[model samples]
Target: MALRFQNIKKKFGDLTVIRDISLDVGDDDFLVLLGPSGCGKSTLLRMIAGLEEVTSGEIHLNGRQVEHLPPSDRNMAFVFQSYALYPHMTVRRNITFPLIMREHKWWFHIPLVGYLAKRRIETKPDIRELVSITAETLGLTQVLDKHPRTLSGGQRQRVALGRAMVRQPAAFLMDEPLSNLDAKLRTAMRAEITRLHHRLGGTFVYVTHDQVEAMTMGTKIALLRGGDIQQFGTPREIYERPANTYVARFIGTPPMNLIEAQFQGDSLRIGDRLLPLPETAPRGDDRKVWLGIRPDAISLTTADAADALPVRVTLVEHAGAESLLAFDPGSLRVARDEDGQSDIMATQSGYSGIVAGDRVGLTLDIAQASYFDIDSGLRID
Candidate 1:
C-alpha cells in the first residue's frame, strides 16, 4: 500500500499550486504533509485520494499508476476536517452507508425502493456485525442509535472515522481531521489516532499545518513552502539537522535563534564576543554566516561565569513546566522574529527566579549550534 508521486504538479488555470514534487511513502508508513496554509499540503492529499486531478506527472499506488482514476476507483478512504456525517442518519446508518453503496443496484436508485433496499442491507448479518465491530473499536457502540446532531464533537469525529474504517481501504487520507476540536479534545484525538494506526497497521497520509501534530504523530514529514518541499525527513532528523533557515525556524517551539555572525580563523564572533568553533564547523576566514542555537541549548548563569555572553532580560514567561526568557544581547542583532522584533530567547526548566530588567550571563552549547551560509540560508556543513 505504498504511494509514490513523481514530478507531480497541480494548477488552477494559470496559478500552479503544486510544483514538480516527487516523494515516496512506504507501506504502513504514517507520512505527514506539513506546512503553513497555502503550501499545497491539502492539495497533495486530495491528489492521492483522486478528489483533485494531477495537472502533470504521475501518482502510483503499489507501483500501479492511479492519477487517472476517479475518486471511487482509488480505494482510499478520506476523513475530512468537518466530520462529514449525515445529520438525518443514525451512527449505525452512517457507518453502514459505504457498504450499501458498494453493493448498489439499478433498482436501488428508485426513491421508495432505494430506502427499502438500504434498510435491508443495513440489517444483514454481516453488515450488522461489521458495523458493530467498528463502533466498539472506536468506542461508538453507545451512540449507534443517535443522530450526528446529538453527538459531541469527538463522537461525531469517531463516526466519520468509523465510516471510513468500514471500507477497509488501502490507505487513510486525512485532511486536518482534528482541527475542528478544542485544544484538549484535539490532544486526546491525536493519541487516539496514533493507537488506531498501530492497531490497523495501514498506510496513512495526513495533511496538517500544526507543527506539534506533525512532530508527535508522523513517522516521516514532508515540509513544504509555497509549492515546493523545503525538507523531508524523520522528526529527529529535521529537528536536529534542518536543511535550511526556513525549516530551522519552522520546526521548534520558540524556534531556533539565528544570529548574524562572522566566521574568523578558528572562532566565531557574535557581536564583540569570540567563541571557539565546534570541531565539525566549516573552516573559513572572515566569512559571514547565520549562527543557529536552540532556546534549550542556552543556559542562564551568573555574569562572571566562563565564556558567558552578557544579556539583559526583557521578558520572562512562565509556561507550566518551563520558563521562556527573552533578552537583549547588547550590540547583537537577532534574526527577525515572527512579530518583526529582534530578541534572543532561552528556556529553563520548572520555575525561574530571573525576571525582566536583570542583567545575566548566557552560555551557549557550542557543539549544538548550527551554521548556515548567510546569503543562501542553507546549512553550512
Candidate 2:
C-alpha cells in the first residue's frame, strides 16, 4: 500500500501552490506533512485522497495509478478536521452512513418509507457486524445513539474516525484532524491515533502546522515551505541536521539559536570574540555563515571555559521543570541579525541560577551545532 507522488504540482490558474513535489510513503509509514499555515500541506494530502485534482503528476497506490480516480474509488479514507458528521443523525447513523451508501441504492432513501429501507440496510448481518465492531474499537458503543450536537469534541472526533475505520481503506488521510481540540484533548488524541495506526498497520498521511504533533507522532516528516519541501527525514535528523536555516529555525520549540558569525579558518569570529569550531565541522571558504545551536546544547557557566562565548543575561523565564536563560552577546554584529545589530541572542535551557543583568559564559556543544551559508540559506556542512 505504498503511495508515490511523482512530480506532483498544484496550481490555481496563475498561482502555483505545490511545485514538483515528489515523495514515497512506505506501506506502514506514518508520514506527516508539516509546515506553517498556507504551506500547501493540506492541498497535497487532498490530491492524494482524490479530493483535489492534480495539475500535473502521477499518484500510485500499491503500484497502480490513482490520479484519475474519484474520491470514493481511491479506497483511501479521509478524516477531516471538522469531523463532517451529520448534525441530525446519531453517532451510529453517522458511522454507518458510509457502509449504507456503499451497500444500498438510491431507492433506499425513499421519502416517507426511507426508515424501513434504512432499517433493512442497517440490519443486514455483515453490515451490522462491521459497524458494531468498529463502534467497539473506537469506544463509541455507549454513545451510539447520541447526536453530534450532544457529544464532546473528543467523542465526535472518535465518531469521525470510526466512520473512516469502517471503510477498511488501505490508507488513512488526515487533514489537521485534531486542531480544533483543546490542549489536553489534542495530546490524548495524538496518542490515540498513533495507537490506531499501530493496531491497523495501515499507512497514514497526516497534515498539520504544529511541530510538536509532527515530531511526536510522525515516523517521518516532510517539512514544507512556500509550496516546496524544505526537508524530509526522521524527527531526529530534521532536528539535529536541518537542511537549511529555515528548517533549523522551524522544527524546535524556541527554535535553534542562529547567530551570524564570520567563519575564518577553524574559528568562528563573533565581532571581537572567537569560538573554536569542533573537529567534525566541515571547513568551508565562505566567510559568512549562520551558526545554529539548540537551546539545550548551550551550557551556561559562571567561569570562562574553552570555546565559550561570554554573554550578558537579559531575561530569565521559569517554565516548570526547566528554565530558559536568555543572553545577549556584547559587541557581536552580523549582517542578518533579526532583532538589532547589537543583539546576539543565546538560549540555555534547564538553567535557573542566572538572572537578568548577570554576565555568563556560553559553552556551545560544537559537535551538535550546525552551520548554514548566509547567502544561500543552506547548510554548509
Candidate 3:
C-alpha cells in the first residue's frame, strides 16, 4: 500500500512530539526514520501505528485517510523495540492469535470448548498454513511448540515478527526491533529484514538510531531531530550530499571530522599550511570556517607531502585490515609527553614528521573537504 502523512502533528500534554511533518512511503518501499535519541522517530512510528494519537493531520493508506482509526482498524502491524511476546504462548498460538481474535464472535466468547467451536473459522486453515510457512521461512519450525521464554533473544524477536506478519497488514512499522540483540546477531537480522521486505513487497517504515543500519537497510531515510525532519532522501543522496553540517557529520562510519580553518584567498588553511581545495569544493564567505573531511578521504603517509600539514602521530589503532592512527596536525595544540616530560605544545605549521615530539607532514584531503560556516554551522559545500 502507498502510505502518506500530511501535516501530521502529535502532542503529549502540551509538548508537541511531532510538528506538521509530512512524508510518504511508496508501495514496497523500505523507509527508515533515523536520528539520535529523543528525536521523536519512535513517537512518529507509534503515531503511525495508532498507539499514539495524532494531534493533527492525515495518515493515508492507498489514498484513504486512516489517521483517526484505532490500532486494530488501521490494517498496519507494529514490531516494537521490546518483542512483547507472551511468555506462556507457543509460537504457533502467537502467530495465530490475531487470526483467532478476528474469527471469534461476541456470541462465541467462552472458555473450554469455545475456542474449538469458534464457528469453524474459514481462514483458520489458511492462517495455520501461513503460520507454518512463515515460521519455516524464518526458521522457527523446530521451535513452533515452544514458549517465548525458552527461545533466544533473536528467536523471540522472530516470534514477535511472525505475529505481526500473520496479521498481513497493509504496511509494517518497526521501531528499533533489532536493538535487543547483540552486534553480530543484529547484523544478520538486518539483512534478513531487508530480504523479508523484498519478498513481502510491502510498505515498511522503520525507526532507528543506528546510522549504519539506516544507511544500509533503508531504500530512503528521513532524518529527524527535535520532532521534525531535518532532511529526507535516498541513502546515497543523504550520505554523499547532506543538507547541513549535522548530516554531513552523521552519515559517515568514522564520522566526518570538522576542524577549524581559515580561508587564505583561494586556498584553505588549517593552521599555516595551505590546502588545495577540490575544484568542486564550496567556497566559504567566513574568513574562518570549519573544514569537514572524512577520515577515509585523507591518506596518511610517512613521506613529506607538499599539500600536507605536519602531524604528530600519538596513537595507532589497527582493526584487522585497516589501521586508524590518531595524529595531531601542526595547527592543533595538544599535550605531548617526550622523554618523560608532559607539556602542552602546538605545532606551528601543522606539519608532520614525528614519532614522538617532532612533526611529520600530514596531508589533508582538501579536494574532498567541505567548508562550513562556523557561525551558522551550515555546510558551504
- The whole-model lDDT of each prediction reads 0.90, 0.84, 0.76
lDDT tens digits, residues 148-243, model 3?
889998888888888888888999899999998999999989988998898888899999999999988999899998888888999988877677
Q: Give the clash count for each candidate.
A: 0, 0, 16
Question: CA shift at 60, candidate 3, in angstroms?
Answer: 1.6
- Mark the regions of model 3 whose C-alpha exceeds 4 Å error after superposition: 105-123, 284-287, 329-359
Tens-digit lDDT string for candidate 1 (266-366): 99888777999878878789998999999999998987677788889999999989999999867786788668967998999998999899999989898
**Inter-residue clash pairs, candidate 1:** none
Top candidate on lDDT is: 1
Residue 280 Cα positional deviation in candidate 1, in Å, after optimal superposition: 2.8
Q: How far is candidate 2 from the true structure (C-alpha RMSD, Å)?
A: 2.6
> Model 1 shows how many backbone clashes?
0
Better structure of 1 and 2 per lDDT: 1
1-381 per-residue lDDT for model 2 (tens digits): 498999999999999999999999888899999998989999999999988899999999989899999887889999999999988778877887877766664545535233743585456878778878988887889998888999999999999999999889988999999999999999999999998888888799999999999999999999999899999999999998999988987898767887777777887776556777778987764388788878878777763655567788888888766787767666654333334433434554454777789887777777888888887989986
TM-score of 1: 0.95
TM-score of 3: 0.86
